[model samples]
Target: MPAADAEVLIVGAGPVGLLLACFLGRTGIPTILLERRSSRGPGSKAIGITPTSLEVLAELGLVDRFLARGVQVRSAAVHADEDARPRPLARLELGGPGAAFPFILSLPQVDTEALLREALGRWPAVRLREGTEAVEVRQESSSVTVRARGPSGGETLLRAPLLAACDGAGSPMAGLLGLRRRVRRFPVAFRMGDYRDESGLGPVAHLYFTRLGSVESFPMPGGLRRWIVQATGAEEPEPSFEKVEAQVLARTGQRLDPGGRVWASAFRPERTELERFRAGRVVFCGDAAHTMPPIGGQGMNTGFADARLLARVLERCRRGGENLENLLALYEPYRRTGFRAAARRSRLFMGVGTLRAAAPRALRNLLVPVLTRPPLSRTLVGHFTMVNVPYSTLSGVLARERRLRLAGEGQADEASGG
Candidate 1:
């Protein structure tokens, strides 16, 4: 209704939103980032940052900050069945020889947000408004407007040329805009807790597929470790440390002390993807656009890739002589293509660890060892690190297609003597 307040308005100041804001802000773009929470929330949500994400951060010169504070997970050992002297079925090394970041950086989500927030402060063009929630959204041809309620119970209208909804899986903006999401909730649930690292495994991650269920142990910062156990569906959603400890011990034969626990929770994994990523001037980013099980650790990293691509699109549209329609038209299809590939990768990782039946479990045990060896292991690690996935913009895809089409035409011209 009124003149645009900023070039871009971002909903949800989570990791994805913050990073998106930083990316835009670095280019001196005017952005308004909104968050409903009054302050940073607690809990270690995502612990693994893929090499691709590190490269994205490296663009903003913040990778060193993350590398300084986060743990480097260089390898993960896969083991089958619990034994007194349990041996690994296979040990897969992360990051190839020519990789920019040779390992997955393990940092809690809170710290990651803090680092992004700190970087955002460097750009005065971007303003982050906390304790402000978007209640209504109106999109027109020229711009999008959002009616938000502040902490004092007052409504304010903020308009922007573009709106990026990085508000997370339960994004209210997606609902307000009537975006349709295809959601599939998995039957299996899991409980995880951060505890002191007593596994003597050092920086390596250990994944155990036992008769009971799957147990994953990963190294975290501050000499802490995170353990995730597949829940039996009877435990409470906010499971106690004792429950997690018992499951880990039964599955991996690793005795865990509840007293050493830092944080714990239980959740049923789900995959949700929007049918369309854009509606008018509004665009969905991060978990607001797609969500996958945390088992594979691609959810947030994929969102980072989304922000990277979206930033490039917005930057091009802002610089002039670019058809914004042509750019935005292929955004959803290209991102959905990448999201589906990443989702399949997540499902592949889940399948091996979550097998229950004797036949499937035995097959997985036999297959994992072979899969984690030499040439094939590089492919698996590439999937894990996301270095091999085509998590990029449609601009590149279109360019390649254009090249092929032109080449075909050139050949046809030569044949016809034109």
Candidate 2:
């Protein structure tokens, strides 16, 4: 009978949470977003934003800002160690009959978060609480209560009818809800960094496969380039600018000065997914729902898609007096299917790139040229850009309708003793 604090309570102010807030606020829904960190972290954890995500941002009126601040990658050049010179084995162009923005945009994760936060400033209905960490979450029959600690070490309780958990892979909220998760850790480790360089690569991303391992380079905004090299093993030395430069030189036969290197870190890719994306009134999105390897750069983009879909569902619920529980139930199957497909694709990419055996590697090298041509190349581009990933609400509705029809037919036959 009492009015809740806000219509929706969102955890984590990362891109997914911020974008969700933007969507809710734009639709005139009151939302409160809580973030554990006081500020955005340094460096770009996830750099590649796909075309589908750009389309979603366009709908939110934030694509122009992203385009201005990000670098447009039109093509990808894959190379092998056999070439005398660092020549591309296959150059796959990423522009075709997809969305308006067909190419992938390379922007720092920090910049993307900043832009989302800036856009949220215009939405008066969204309140962001940075440095506020949710310590516990309790779900009642009709509402959810979140207990959070503030910067001054004081605790506060906020209640809302809906909760969106966007808190990343090690999601505390998901843990609090006792959700089951499947996580897979790969043996591959990578060291990556951004450097100030004028590599003639320009808008073209480069991927080099050598006897040592795979090395990837993508041009960033403001004369900067991001380089990532797959490590030999987990016990390999700590990643440094000097080491990355040396690896690039050895793998691709290209000289990259280590000077002006901005940030560098090491990471091992992992795949994680929840059995479902919802628990009562609390729903999960972004890394909270699923996390895949960074090979296709679908992790963040997938999260963006999650936010867009949930916002649509919530907006519909607000307009119509529909049962919120039934509408929210649709989020799990729709998103879990996409997450599984994307994760499998990412694993295939990593597996192919890290083929260690001599015979398979040779065969892959010989077949890659043919695979990167024409129809196959186009398919690969579409898959990587996420244009091929289906996120249709109509499909869900049609499936539901079919189920209802079948149930009705069964009841009729049983009642008539047929």
What does candidate 1's lDDT look like per residue over 100-190, in tens digits?
8989999999999999999998999899999999989988889999998898989999999899999899778889877789999877888
Residues 304-365, model 2: lDDT tens digits: 88898899888888899776777777778878877777888888888888777778878989
What do the candidate models score in CA lDDT, each in turn?
A: 0.88, 0.85
Cα lDDT for residue 322, candidate 2: 75
- Model 2 CA lDDT for position 186: 90
> Which ten contiguous residues of candidate 2 have the minimum total lDDT?
390-399
Per-model C-alpha RMSD: 2.2, 2.7
TM values, all candidates = 0.95, 0.93
| Candidate 2 to truth, TM | 0.93
Top candidate by TM-score: 1
